[model samples]
Target: MENINEALGLLLVGLTTVFVILYLVGLIGNGVIYLTNRFVPEETMAKRKEIVKGKAKPTNPAKIAAVIAAVEAVTGGKGKIEKIDKIDKIEK
Candidate 1:
């Protein structure tokens, strides 16, 4: 039927238009992120010369990562570790 054909054509046109619009939005978002990163580079954190002072051995990166992950999980991603210090002894 001519009506059915016309409806199908309209549907196809609408879908194509939406897809093109979404694709353009995605492209623009990516372009903005790329431009921002390129123009305003993120600052790098300074590396510590000594993670532990006197008697304490160097800390393992895996342990640090696990601790950070645990803190994030506990705080629901609101926690941040500013500094880590070695505990010489624990009081009862």
Candidate 2:
């Protein structure tokens, strides 16, 4: 009984230590990712320009009209007209 109790105590301590180490490693990894995301410079404009140029698509006026109509319908067609004008002006 004494030996069994001692072994169980050691096992619990070992498991606790492992759990703490794993938690600390996860914390440090997350901090690194956050810091890098905040401080790292984004892709250069040349790269961005190339990427955008590669994916050009013709504008679809009908889709734009449909979305505006949906917004007006959802907003009960009252304040929506002013809201639509605001959005159009902002886009311009």
Candidate 3:
């Protein structure tokens, strides 16, 4: 009975220690990210925001032709591009 009790106690302590360490790591990681973003310059942040939002620009005709050609080749002339639109990349 004593041996069983001692083993259980040790197991509990080990689990608790692991949980505390993981929690602290998560807390510190969040804090660092928050601070870094908060201190970032507005201009740089604006650029990042624009990139995240996927601001559209005129497409190069040569690039568009190349993409269409590749798609047709891959699909054996069955693929067609009706429209193209910019999509923002989602970050976790």
TM-score leader: 3
Per-residue accuracy of model 2 over 13-78 as CA lDDT, tens digit each: 999999999999999999999987677666654565554564432255565577677777888876
Ranking by lDDT: 3, 1, 2
Error of 3 at 37 (Å): 1.9
Off by over 4 Å in 1: 44-92
lDDT per residue for candidate 1 within 33-83, as digits (tens), equals 888768763442112324343333434656666667889999999998876
lDDT of 3 by residue, 23-74 (tens): 9999999999999889988888887676556553423556656667888999
- Regions more than 4 Å wrong, model 3: 56-66, 75-92
Q: Point out the higher-scoring one by lDDT: 1 or 2.
A: 1
Scored by Cα lDDT, where does model 1 land?
Answer: 0.69
Q: What value of lDDT does candidate 2 attain over all alpha carbons?
A: 0.66
lDDT of every model, 2 decimals: 0.69, 0.66, 0.74
- Give residue 53's error in model 1 in angstroms: 27
Model 2 residue 3 lDDT score:
100
Clashes of each: 0, 0, 0
Span of ten consecutive residues with least summed lDDT in model 2: 81-90
